[model samples]
Target: MALPAASVQLYSLAKEFTADPQGSLDRLAAIGLKNVEAFDFVRRPAEIRSALDASGLVSPTGHAPLLTDELWTPDGSIPTPAPEVVFEAAAAIGIQTVIDPFVAPERWLTEEGVADIAERLNSAAEKAATFGLNVGYHNHAQEFVASFGDHTAYERFVSLTDERVQLELDLFWALTGGQDVPALVSRLGDRLTAVHVKDGIVPASNPWAPGAEAFGSDSLDQRHAGTGEVPLAAALRAGSAIQYAVIEYDRAPGDVFADIEASLGFLREGGFVA
Candidate 1:
């Protein structure tokens, strides 16, 4: 099956990116990648954009917080700016989609909380249009912690959001949350604009469930694409409209760039990308 353009989420090499943005991007470009996913860039769009221009890399999708007071990552938290400010920066950096990468686990367990997320994203999506941008959400295992009726909080949130508010499901996290990864991807249909093309063994325990609030990521042994538990090929085949097959790692199993190259090779060998 024909696949989306292959890209790497910059967060996969956060240390290298922070220490030497230009060198880091050049290194990825050397790996034969022309696209990358931006993370935590709402604060320094111009700086990042300059590097992208120099390196000839395009950031079509990025991570930012539009609904929450702050965004959290394994590294730390970033206070959010107004949605309009975010859109301006995203537009400046030439990002087509600004995807909120995480929301706390506590927020996904209730009806009111899920609606609030959908409402905020829908409002943001409307504002994003003026900037020639799209808004989306990226999932972690927490999104599946609670089920309303027969569906997960993740599914409920998807149903509530406007179609313009899209999704980027993290496959490894979905498996970590005890989901049938490929089936879930298909269920999302065309709303999935991109997916965190993660491949890792699901931990023996689903630690991000509602009560397990102090979830940790150390247990996740993320491997190269197609080498772990996630059914990446099946899932990729299901996303008919996916625009980017983004490689990522919450924690690198080894040298980060080498791991990225390995995933890119998997994409090529699987014919998941050109």
Candidate 2:
């Protein structure tokens, strides 16, 4: 199979990017990246598009909230925008697939909740098509916290969502949830269009599990790709139709740009991306 293209989630350098969008993107371009996965871009699509264009980079996929009333992060919650609004913004930024980055942990714990999440994303996908865009979902460890009989909530979610909805799995989070990362990638098969190339020491416990204390990105022990515990190479190899291997860090281990470069180096040296 052909290798996927290397991309970075702009969230990896959110602070720097927020401070200097164009300069940050230019630095990524200097590192030889041709593609990026935008984050929190719905509010300023035109500015981001201009920056990406100036940097000679393209954002084929981006993150936005679609299935939730309000988007939650470890830090705070952002009010969710309407799907039509999201699609319009994504199209403006040249994003082909708008992926919802998170759904609350409690929402992934039951049959009905998982079904609702899938149904909402499926509907969003239909609406997004009108704007010449597609919609997808990204998972955190929360998706694996509950199972209905033999299937994980994540598995059931995949089965419920339409084919048009894509999946972007975070390998480190999957491992944190006690999954065999490469095996899950194989099962996801062609639908897995992207993988978050994040590597880190697995947290001692599932932080999203019920009763766990609140935590933020600063608490993560993330490392450059292949330097941590995640089976990134095996997971990348297992993907049958992966198109973008996106490097991300909830928290960078060092200078953010250098950290991103190190992960990009891993992808290049390991022959995981084109």
Candidate with best lDDT: 2
What ranges in model 1 sit over 4 Å off? Answer: 213-216
lDDT of each: 0.89, 0.94
User: Considering summed lDDT, which 10 consecutive residues are worst modelled in model 2?
Assistant: 68-77
* Local accuracy of candidate 1 as per-residue lDDT tens digits, 1-274: 3468999999999899999999999999999999999988988999999999999999999998887898777657789999999999999999999999888888898999999989989999999999999999999888888899999999999999999888998988898888898899889988988988888877776666645535445656889999998999998988877888999998889999999999999999989986
Model 1 clash pairs are none
> lDDT tens digits, residues 9-115, model 2?
99889889999999999999999999999999989999999999999999999999998888887767889889898889999999999999999999999999999
**Top-scoring candidate (TM-score):** 2
Quality of model 1 by C-alpha lDDT: 0.89
RMSD of 2: 0.7
Give per-model CA RMSD: 1.3, 0.7
RMSD of 1: 1.3
